[model samples]
Target: MQFKNRPNECVTTTDGREVWLSRSVATAVCILLECEGRPYILVNQRGPGMPDFAGYWNLPCGYLDYDETTAEAAMREVWEECGVNTLELLAQATCEFFSAPWDVNSTPRGARQNVTIHHGLFARVAQLPPVSNANNEPDETTDIRWLPLSDVETLTFAFNHHERIADFLAHVEKLAGISYR
Candidate 1:
């Protein structure tokens, strides 16, 4: 699947020189396991207005703000995107993807204009408290669901997120000494 909106781009500066600009965005994806020690994954409904992966099932995550640590951003985004305030990081992993710079002249308003090297940080939440979104904008997520890891294939997840989900599930399955296809 080709995403029209990418993080990298080239621009023509005032001097008529082509300038390449790249952006680094950090996101935290939460895999909230069932509190009863069962093997299940927590997912959230993405906010409708989000340009990428909106209205789909996704892990609780968002961009790491400037001056914020990855851990800080992870916990914060979890609470903001989902109604989970008591989240604790159980583990972490990262994934990155690259795209060529593209013109944003036809891009959506307020889009991140540049080539983006996005870092996805995976986190396991220890405490899953029922929470609400603090962000006033049409939040990127509106609902949350807990599903067995085996059912991940049934959810409509973003392209970049699928691999990380599989990797995390595999790690957990290995730790529990359970066989998963």
Candidate 2:
């Protein structure tokens, strides 16, 4: 059966059966760093006037462009939102996928019916790099920070990022053969 007035949302298969389109794919980057022998992760505050979760903190993330791989999209989002070049930094990174469904009435702009694929790009660093937009123009992020893992529980995270952060930390703990608690 064809969906009425929603041609883009449905497609006919070779067997002539109509199927709903798959969910959109987005990428979320978890840039892990080590500072002063402690672990930190990159996060950014959504700028004011954002369609969803404005003023709340989130990982450097965006939708995957049609011409790029998920890894490339993650790296691009990192540079765009945090001004950090991840091409060299992500040599040792790992990736994970997660499914995120928006509330019926709470879908954000550009992310309706999308599923986020979380990418964890962990790196060891001695110092934090300064973050600024390459074009010196305002964008989606208002603040960028390298937050200590121990302090992550105290902040409000957007897009279910708190769970994503926890998962990353758990993975780190498993790799390091240690547990936080």
Candidate 3:
């Protein structure tokens, strides 16, 4: 059987023999909170103690638990990483499709053995309440902030998150009237 475009489900690879090997499925929510007529994106700095990609900037995102929707994962990640309860999802975007090489040595617990980087983007409109939690956070993520998308290019963030930043810059123009050519 072939796969249809399901925004929330991960599809198995084309080869029929790969059952246990599955694609890495994850999602991200880009909350564009407006302040002073400017668009600011919520960003997080990886925890210094994280084993990989530590001290790097990235969007508030995390893996989806079994039976959880992308939107749910996004909201949960935002709350866990930043302690803000978002009201609703405003818009959603999918990353450009690309085939990623399969790796045999890297194994993150609960990570899909067949890892392909597919990104889903979400936008939240309302302001979130200030609530911080120390116990409920991924070891790899630390420090959260909302910054202007135009100024984000100056920061040296992990390479994987650069595409989201580009998408974010586009959203800033569409939502906040900020243009970058």
Which prediction has the highest lDDT against the true structure?
A: 2
Better of 1 and 2 by lDDT: 2
- Regions of model 1 farther than 4 Å from truth: 1-20, 86-128, 134-136, 173-181
Using all chains and alpha carbons, the TM-scores for the candidates as numbered come to 0.59, 0.73, 0.60
Give a tens-digit lDDT track for model 2, residues 1-181: 7653334478889999998876677888777777677878889888875778989999988878889877777778888888987765655343222122111222335537666666665556667667765621365878888888888988899887888777766765666544443
In model 2, the clashing pairs are none
* Stretches > 4 Å off in candidate 3: 1-19, 88-135, 171-181
Residues 37-94 of candidate 3: C-alpha lDDT, one tens digit per residue: 5656677788866666788887776677889765666667777887766543333212
Ranked candidates (TM-score, high to low): 2, 3, 1
CA displacement after TM-score superposition, residue 6 of candidate 2 (Å) = 11
C-alpha lDDT of all candidate models, in order = 0.52, 0.70, 0.55
> Which is the winner by lDDT between candidate 1 and candidate 3?
3
The whole-model C-alpha lDDT of candidate 3 against the native structure comes to 0.55
Residue 34 local lDDT, model 1: 48
RMSD of candidate 1 to the true fold? 9.0
The candidate 3 region of ten consecutive residues with least summed lDDT is 95-104
